[model samples]
Target: MSDTRNAPHVDMLRSPLGRVRGLGSAHRGAVTWWGHMLTSISLVPLTLWFIWSMVGLVGASREEVALWLTRPVPLALMLLLLVATFYHMKHGLETVVEDYVHAAAPKFALLLAIKGISILLGLLCIISVLRLGL
Candidate 1:
């Protein structure tokens, strides 16, 4: 029921790809994606090892568990697990915040909080393990 004679050309509203090439490119997309994939892949083996270790220690007394942790390999692996877990967690939360939170200030604040909390918790966990193991 509307007149089309005076309408603007459809092509006028469409941008040519050449003209818009790098306008909105965030250069870090590939790095972030790679980080996500690597973390997820690393988590599989680390998580499995943690589960297997815990299962093996199910009936162990506190001292037995501590003694097992005191071994160099166990202590190192535990540290690696904690690091990978926290880094993965932080990366995931940052992605969520970047995707969902559009506002600049709030997005930045959320990212800062996520990083701060993740580091704090990771350090606490590492310290706990060290205390128990060493």
Candidate 2:
């Protein structure tokens, strides 16, 4: 029972119960951290592929771009990139809001808005990609 009152940094105010339980109430543990890292790593390759693909599309007509996307591999890869990106973005934004937004109401509102917009726009993009394949 060292005095938390005299603790220099002030973050040492955990209850004995909190210290013992380890996971505490929030309980995300390493999973969220690992997911964030994995998504970050995955984005590197996807982003590079996207940049190259766009560069190739630069001088092309819309019909040529559409034709390129109509291939099975390109269509699949694009969908995977979109899904991973939107999922990663949602988690990252949620983490930012959770860490920075102190007010509960605003945190909840921002999280809700983020999830909603991510899903809506992601679906629209996926649909657009699919249409190009068609």
Candidate 3:
């Protein structure tokens, strides 16, 4: 341990090149922050509409449910929610895997698996919603 008064403290907000002594990659914090903001903004209305629609279906009959789901706008919205939800899940899970998984191969494998499963589940849910509409 060196003298605390003279030692420099790490600044997390600074670019890697500014803080680091040697080689550093270009900063991507802003890009990641924008991506997160976009996802969050898109999810807000999608989640609200999905919950509201489900509430409306609570006591609906089979035909009523089918008709409601089959409408073009609702079907499209449902599909959009399915895709967006899965994408968000994939992004979150990737962050978790990257943070916790230490080994290279396992991290890569887990990330790939999460992405694959998210896509598959998203597609399945979309198909089910479409089928209900039909």
TM-score winner among the candidates? 2
In model 1, residue pairs whose N, Cα or C atoms come closer than 3 Å (at least 3 residues apart or on different chains), thus clashing, are none
User: Model 2, 34-101: lDDT tens per residue?
Assistant: 77788788889988988988898899998998999999988887998898899898988998998899
Better of 1 and 3 by TM-score: 1
Q: Candidate 1 — which residues are off by over 4 angstroms?
A: 1-24, 27-29, 59-61
Residue 89 in candidate 1 has what lDDT? 94
**TM-score of candidate 3 relative to the true fold:** 0.70
Pitting candidate 1 against candidate 3, the one with the higher lDDT is 1
- Model 2, residue 28: C-alpha shift (Å): 3.0
Model 2: colliding residue pairs:
none
Give each model's whole-structure lDDT.
0.85, 0.85, 0.81
The TM-scores of all predictions, comma-separated, are: 0.72, 0.75, 0.70
TM-score of 2: 0.75
Candidate 3: tens digits of C-alpha lDDT, residues 43-85: 8999999899999989889889789888999988888778778
Is candidate 2 or 3 superior in TM-score? 2
All candidates in order of TM-score, best leading: 2, 1, 3
lDDT of 3 at 81: 79
Writing each residue's lDDT as its tens digit, candidate 1 over 18-130 gives: 33552224434345666778878988988999999999998899999889989998899999899989988999999899889999999999999999999999999999899
